[model samples]
Each structure stands twice: as structure tokens, then as C-alpha cells.
Target: MTESVMPTYGRLDVAFTRGEGVWLYDEQGEAYLDALSGIAVCNLGHCHPAVSRAIAEQAQILMHTSNVYQVPLQSLLATKLTELSGMSQAFFCNSGAEANETAIKIARKYGHSKGIDKPVIIVMDGSFHGRTMATLTATGNPKVHAGFEPLVPGFVRVPYNDIDALRMAVSHWPEAVAVMLEPVQGEGGVKVPAAEYLDEVRTLCTQRKLLMMLDEVQTGIGRTGEWFAFQHAENSLPDVLMLAKGLGNGMPIGACLISGAAVDLLEPGNHGSTFGGNPLACRAALAVINTIETNSLLAHVTLMNQQIVAAFEHALSGAEGVQFRSKGFMFGIELPIACTELVKQALAKKVLINVTADKVVRLLPPLIMSADEANKMVNIVSELVLAFLATQPKASVA
Candidate 1:
């Protein structure tokens, strides 16, 4: 047998041929309700009309032009992102890793400007930035650092939601120049910190003269029932914000946005990308934002999230350790046991879901999902969970 692709992913047996909205079809045309949404990329759902149309149109008209040339669509997308996020400027890239890479570079340069030689940044535990060298090093999971020895330095790890511990750590390192964290840790089992956690971080950073950076790559683009997760969120604006996943709906697009003092760190020759900010990607992202606004999808996400959460609580009532946490469509259900098998089980029941952090069932359904669709997912997943629980031993699996 031949395997041309690298064995990088623990891929499932099934393969989807096509998708529309919150449903996908296999080669035989069997439908499966999509709850993962390509790991939160398809906020507009798979094959969204506006995004697809824009991509197709732009492909025919203009797909790629060197970054040296003016790209009107890219400028337009940047303007929309800046206006919505209250960020002053944006540097576009093709993926979240690149976006985070850009942010890291800015932090380093800003630190050098402030006369700090090492330029240390504080990252939280259980964080997932990207797979690139610097972003992987910034990611707090030790597993990512395995096999990649001599990991990128200057990133200090600390406990999440522990402001005092962070302060202590920062005091030890005079090179500390920035603090980066997620508004909601998506890959960390969708863990949300204390309500005032970000506010406290902003206060600490201001007092310590450290730049506040937010990795909203998974939570941005209306995933948290807002234009951006940090929009109107405690007035704790970050100096550097990285976004991807859902920004272009399904296309590869990442944005490193900056504001306040960190705005002028990167100059003309400091950073650049060949395929970034191209016309096609920009057109697709513009269409995603336009459709999200035109369809009022944020309100829909909020309503659907509430409905689904209430339904899950009612259906799994008193099921041991079957509690859930949700913000917008990003949800996590903590199971009593490791339920990695739930992926295939849900597929058998014509639904799709994923397990993360060993025992948390993570769901990132499409934001435009309807009331009826949300109820269907609740019912389908509830039945599967109850059945799976019955097969376990009497004692809790933990």
C-alpha cells in the first residue's frame, strides 16, 4: 500500500464528499449533521454561497498578485476587520500560525525598542496557537514541543486564570515584555477563565508595562456571539490580536491586528508575505464578514447556543459528570470517561462531534444553525451519550 500524505493526523475512517450548511454528505450521499465545522473554520457553514461565490468570481477575475502591488480587496477586508475589532492596523497571512508568528515578531521588536534584550512573553498552560516553530513553542502543551528540541525561547509558561502566579513569574524575568492568552481557550477543552480574568490581565500588563496579546484565532469571527470575542468585552483591548480559522469562513486567511503602542513596531521591510493578502482570499473574507452582518448571525448563534445548552442539560440531567460549558456555538461537555469513541458513535447516528482534552466533547457547530437544526443535534447527541453511558461499568470511569 502507498500513503502519499504524511501521517500527521489521527484521521477518522469516514470521508465527507460535500457539505452544505450544518450537514455533510458522503460519497454515497448519506447525510451527517456537522457539529465540528471543520474545527471552527466554517462559521458560515460548508460551501457557503457568499464565500463560494466570491471565491469563484475572484478566481476568474484575479487570484494572485505580488504583495508589491496594491490589492483593493485586501485593503477593504483590513478596514472591515480594524473597524469591527477597534484595531488600528492589520498584517494578513494565510493561516493562524503565520498570524501568531507575526504577533511574536512584533512583540520581539517592541521589546528591543524598549531596550529589553531577551523579550520574554508569558503564555498560559493548555494553550494551542499553531504548529509552526514559534507558535508551537508559544503553545503551552508540552506534547507540541516533543521531537522539536531546542524549542523557540523567550516564551514563559504560567497557570491559566492565575493572575498572582503570572505576576510572580513576570517579576522573576526582567525580559518580560508581553502577556498572550486566549479570550476562551478553544483547544483547551473550550475552557473559559474567570469572568474578570482578562480585565485583571490588562491591569497587570498596564502596571508592568507589558504588551497584552490575545490569541482569538478560534474564538474570533463571531464564534463568541460578537464581531470579535473581545469586542465590548470588559474594555480590555489587546495591543496584538491574532485571528484565523473562521475569518475566511473556509479559505486560508489569517490576520495579525495591532493597536495602541504596538502599532508602529513593524515597518516596510520588517515583515512581508508572498501569498498573503491576495485578492481571492480577501474577497472571500470580505464576503464572510458581509454575510455574517447581513444575516444577523451573531444573534442567531446566541439564541441557538442557549437552546442547545438548555436542551443538553435537560436531556442529560443527573447523568454523572455529564455537565456542559458553552459560549455561543463553542461548547464542551465533560464526560465521566474518555469518550474518544464518541466520534465514530456519533457518525453512526448521523451526527458529527469531537473529543478534546481526553474527556471533553467539543462542539463548534455552524453559527447560522437554525432552531430546528439545533434541536435535532441535541436529540441525536443525547441519545448517543445515554447509550454509551449504559455500556460503561457501574463506577465512574475516572
Candidate 2:
């Protein structure tokens, strides 16, 4: 099996046979609390009834008819997404990177439509857009760009949440036409900016006539205790909003929700996806959004977030260099020392978690996690952290 499978992922030894809500069961019937939620894809938890039913029903009805013909499910999903997002139009795709790739294309086209032959999109440092060529180039981490040289240009990098620097870049770069950043920097160790950051970015984009693009792949779809993280603010609106991850509740679906000045940027034949907006995917996404709304999961997520945060604080209180920043269920516990090995260690204890940006323990638990499960997650991880720190001997310097 290893011979045939690609060596792209450093997969874990344990193979999960099934998952429900927030728990995964391995082949041997061992249970693991899945705090990562398949890296935020299984938002409604594994095999959500509504989403599963939608998938099965749509499977019986239709699956793919391409973008050439009418896909009612696709149109319906778009309508609901735009209604939720306050966007005017939507272009469906299959993943976060693809959605972002579409957003990049839209921004470039919007710039060119204004006679700017080569448009420059201002991207933030520490941003994770996608793995495609354009998105990887736009990504801030130098490590992602190491092997992939001759990257796609037309993107200017700026420090995230820095208004003055962003404004300066716009004024300095004549070709700058758009500004892109995540609402909460999810992959950059779940970095949460100041409260006024999104408003400031929106104001700058509006005043500068630049498209404000938000990559909400990891932060969207009730993960942040709201329909989207931007909803936390009144004036938070992006011209090009990219979404994926939780949108389909595990089914592959990505969307580029456009509003304001950039709504009409894409033209026919300019860009499209063959499998994007297929009936099955659209139905899955619809079920996801509908289920979230019907079950009041947003409110649940908000309360769960508070409960989890309180537990984390209680667990780590008075511990030096130990603290957490969280919005809704998205959290990152920063430690005094690097602890990449914590992932394997935690897995050994049957609790799935991830370490990002070196020392930030990133936890994106399932939205349906009960208060009891949430407490269990916190307890296990807190014990793990305390144990790990206790085992480490003090370092001496000359």
C-alpha cells in the first residue's frame, strides 16, 4: 500500500475506521477525541445526518452535469451563501486553494478592467492561501516557497494587521489593486488580530478603491461562533470572500463570494471549474449551511468557545509563557518552548491535536462537541502540556 500511495503526507500510524460527532474509532475500536476536525473540514462532525442525507439524496438524483447546464442545487447553494455573506455573486470551486486562486484571478481581472495591465495584489505575511502555484507564491512562509521557485508574481507582501504598513504599500506600489488577508490567521498559529483590524482594512480598501479579499477557508462556516468570523464586526465586508473547509461539512466545495465593486469582475469563459458546483457538492454545502442555521450551532459554538476558553485558562493559569488566544472554537496555546513532538505524544493519549507555527498548539475541534467532550479535550491537552513541560530540563546558556 505504501508503494502505491503518494509520499506527500507524513500520515499517522493509527487508521480511523469511523467517526461520529467529535470522536473517531480506530480499527481496533480505540476512541480518539478529534480536536482537529480533519484540519477544520469536518465542521459539523463526521457524518452529520443532514449532510449525509443530502449527499445520499443527491447521489440518487444527480451528481455532475458540468457547468455547461443548469445545476439547481448549485444555484441554490450560491444563493444561500451569498445571502449569508452579503455578497452579490458566487463562483464555486473544490478547495480553499482553488477558491483563493479564483479570487486572485478575479482581482487581477478587476485591475485589468481598469486598464492596469499588470495588477498587484497586496498579500499579508504569515498568510496560508493554498498550495497551488499562485497561492503558494502569495503565501508568506519562505519554507513553502523553497522548492517552488519562479513563482507567480503580481503580489506584494505586507505585515498583517498593520494598517500603516498596508496604506504605505498601497501608496508606494502604483500597481496595487487589492488587499488580501485572513480574518483570523488560522494556519499562522491561529493569530487573532486586534478588534479594529478588519474595520481598518475595510476602510482602507474602500478609500483606496482596492478589492478587499478575505480568505476565510479555516475561519468560516460557524467555526468562529458565527456564520463567519467577519460577522463579529459590523463594518467587516470583503469584496472577494473565499471559503472552503467547513462549507461542505466534509464534502469538497469551495466558493468565491463577491460583493461591492468586484462583484462583476469575472466574465464568461474567463474562469471556471468542471466539477465545481456539481449537484452533489452543492447539496452537501446546502445541507451544511442549513443544518448550522436550523440547529442554532452558531450560538452553541459561541457558548462552547467560552466554556473551552475558561477551562484552558483555568488549566494554564499562572504558568509562565503559557497562554491562549481564541475566537469561537479556534484556539492556539503558545508555549515557552518548541513542542512539535506534542502531536505524536497527544495522539498516543487518543486525543488528536496539531502544532502550528512551531510552538502554538492549534485546536479546531468539531462544532458539535458537547461541553463534556470539550472539557475532556481541555483536560487531556492541559495534562499533556504540563507533563511535557515538566519533563523538559532547563536550558543553560554561556
Candidate 3:
């Protein structure tokens, strides 16, 4: 077959034709239990009726009108998002990268406003922001920055979950304007920081008057058992919050929200996206928010997170060198050895999963996943891990 698409991604051989709830169907009509939710993009599952209908209805009525005119749906979505996030304003874009880029711009501009000629936004080690030049430079992964040198300046690096390191960094760099990071470090092997980490960071940022930016691209939209991951921390509201992944439940949409110290940073003509916040996208996002609210999916996720984590703990209790962690539907199991092959093994079992950071099996099942489906996914994945471990040479436990 002649391949026209760019080989940017090392895609799997199988192609899915359709999806519903937590199940995906291949071209041959085989079912694969989806545990990754399109890398946490489809929170409500594939083809959710509300979101699909909203897109369809809006497509028939309007899809794009450019950012020159007022987009009512965009305004409505912004209002709803602000109400939910406690943010003062919202800027929309087409992907997580753009949202983070918007955030980076805000940080730099805010720094410039303070008369800092060169500004620096502190980022964390092992964090993944986006693929754009600025965002990829902001990201802490070497692989993302390998081929893109002469990288954008003004981003400093620090260790994740270390408040003292952040404090030291802030003190060392007097021109630092903001601290940007993920709540759970999604692509960083689902690393969850100390419970007080966010609160402490918030306090430090407040004391220093620096923007506390959170990249919730993979943790927002109820993925972390909260409306936003920052909500999990007591009184931790970021100056800048970026979201995308599950915002529109598979639709392409990203938002950079602002509050104190970060508001009004980007003036008109400073930044704009032609397709951002168009009617179709905003309509779908509205439906997603409405559906989540109506279904009480947030509470459901909280409960399900408890249940699934307990299940994983019990299933892998005696497994050597295995550690499990989760926040809401974001699950990670770190094995003793490199287990990238487990992705292919799970696919053979008609279960879809992802391996990040070489050893962590990252699972992001849909929020609408049924208890039965959840149990099935757990069983399949647990069995696969056990079988794979049994084949490997046993290592001594500490």
C-alpha cells in the first residue's frame, strides 16, 4: 500500500473502524476494549450522543466564522468554563500545544510588563507540554527537544514535586515570571506529587507574585476525579490553567484560562487563532460539559477511581517490583523491567493500553466505562502483567 501520511507516529498495524462506550471495532469487526481513551481525549467515550449531536447540529447551522466576529457559543463555553474553574477569562485554540503556547506567551508578556527584559518560566523534569517549538522547548523531555535545537529560551527546569527545588530556582532566577507544570505529570509516567505539593507551590507563587500555571491538558475535564486537577488541592487555584484532551470529548479544542496575576496579559492583536472557538467546536464542548454535569460523571469517576485502584492493588499485591498509582481514571503500573512490548501483548488480547516511560503501563479508560467493562479491563491487564512477569527472570525485592 502506498502511504501518503507522514510517518511521524509509530502507529500500530490495526485500524479501528468504529467505537462505542469503552469498546472499539476493527475493520474485521473484532472488539478491542479501549483503556487509553484515545490518549485521554475521549472522556465520555466514542460517539457520545450529546457531543455528536451538538457537532452535527452546529455543523448544519454554523462551523466557522473566524475570530473577527463574536462567537456566541465560544462566549458561552468560556463563561461555563470560568464558572467551573474559578478563572476570570478564557482563550481558545485548536490543541493542547496552542493552549500551552498561549500560556507561555502570557507568562513572557507578564514578565515583560514587570520590566524583565528576558523572562523565564520554570518547568519540571519529565513533563510533557506539547510539540510546538515553544511548548516543546518548555517541555522537559530530551526526546521532544532532541531535533529542535536553538530552542526557545525563557524556560528553566526543576525537579517535579520538589517545592524546595522550585523555591531555589525562583530565587536563583530573579527574572522568573511563572512556574508551569502538570498536576499529575501525565506523560511523565502518571507521576502524582505529594499531597501538599500543589498547595505549597501555590503559596510560593503567591508569596513571590509569580504566575502559577498548571498544564491540565491530560488531567482536566474530570480526568482526575475533579473538574480540574488543581481542585484536588485545598485552595490551589492557578494563575493560568491550560486544558484540551477531554474538553470537547474528541473534538479539537484547547483553552488557556487566566485568573489573578495572569489576567489581561494577552491584549487584542497579541494572539489569535482563526479556527479557535468556532461554533461547531464550542457547541460540542458545551454538550460535553452538560452531559458530564447531568450524568454526575465527576462523582462517578471519584467512586470508580477508588474501586479500580483497590482492584489493581489487590490483583498485583504480591507482584515483585510493581507499583501502582492513579488519580481518577488515570492509572499507571510501573513494572520491574521495560515492558513496552506489553502494549502489543495487550492488543493481542483484544485490549488496548499504552506504555509510557518504558516501564509504566498507562491506562486511561473512558469515564463512561461500565463497572463490568472496568473489571474486564483490569482482569485482562492484570493477567497480561502477571504472565509477562512470570517469563522474566525474578529479581530480588528490597
Pick by lDDT: which candidate is best? 3
Alpha-carbon TM-score of each model against the true structure: 0.97, 0.98, 0.98
Instruction: List ranges where model 1 is wrong by over 4 Å.
Output: none
Q: Worst 10-residue stretch by lDDT in candidate 2?
A: 389-398
Each candidate's lDDT (Cα)?
A: 0.89, 0.91, 0.94
lDDT of 1 at 212: 92
**Cα lDDT of model 2 by residue, 1-398, tens digit:** 37699987778889999988898999999999999999999998999988999899989988999899988888898899888888888999999999999999989998998899999999999999989999999898998899899999899999988999999999998888899899999888899998999999999899989999999999999999988899898798899899999999889999999999887777899999999989999999989999898999999999988899999999988566786999998999988888889999999999999998888999999899998999999999999998888777756100
Instruction: Please rank every candidate by lDDT, starting with the best.
Output: 3, 2, 1
Ranking by TM-score: 3, 2, 1
Per-residue error (Å), model 3, residue 239:
0.6
Q: Give me the overall lDDT of model 3.
A: 0.94
lDDT of 1 by residue, 1-398 (tens): 13998889888778889999999998889999999899999999999988999899999999999899898998898899999999999999999999999989999999999998889999999999999999999998889889997998899999998989998998998999999899898888889888888888988888888889999999999998987777636878999999989998889999999998798889899999999989999999999999999999999888787788889999989677686888888999888898889888998888889888877889899998888988888898888888888899978653
What lDDT tens digits, residue by residue, belong to model 3 across residues 166-207? 999999999999999999998999999999999999999999
Candidate that beats the other on lDDT, 1 or 3, i.e. the better one: 3
Q: How many residue pairs clash in each candidate?
A: 0, 0, 0
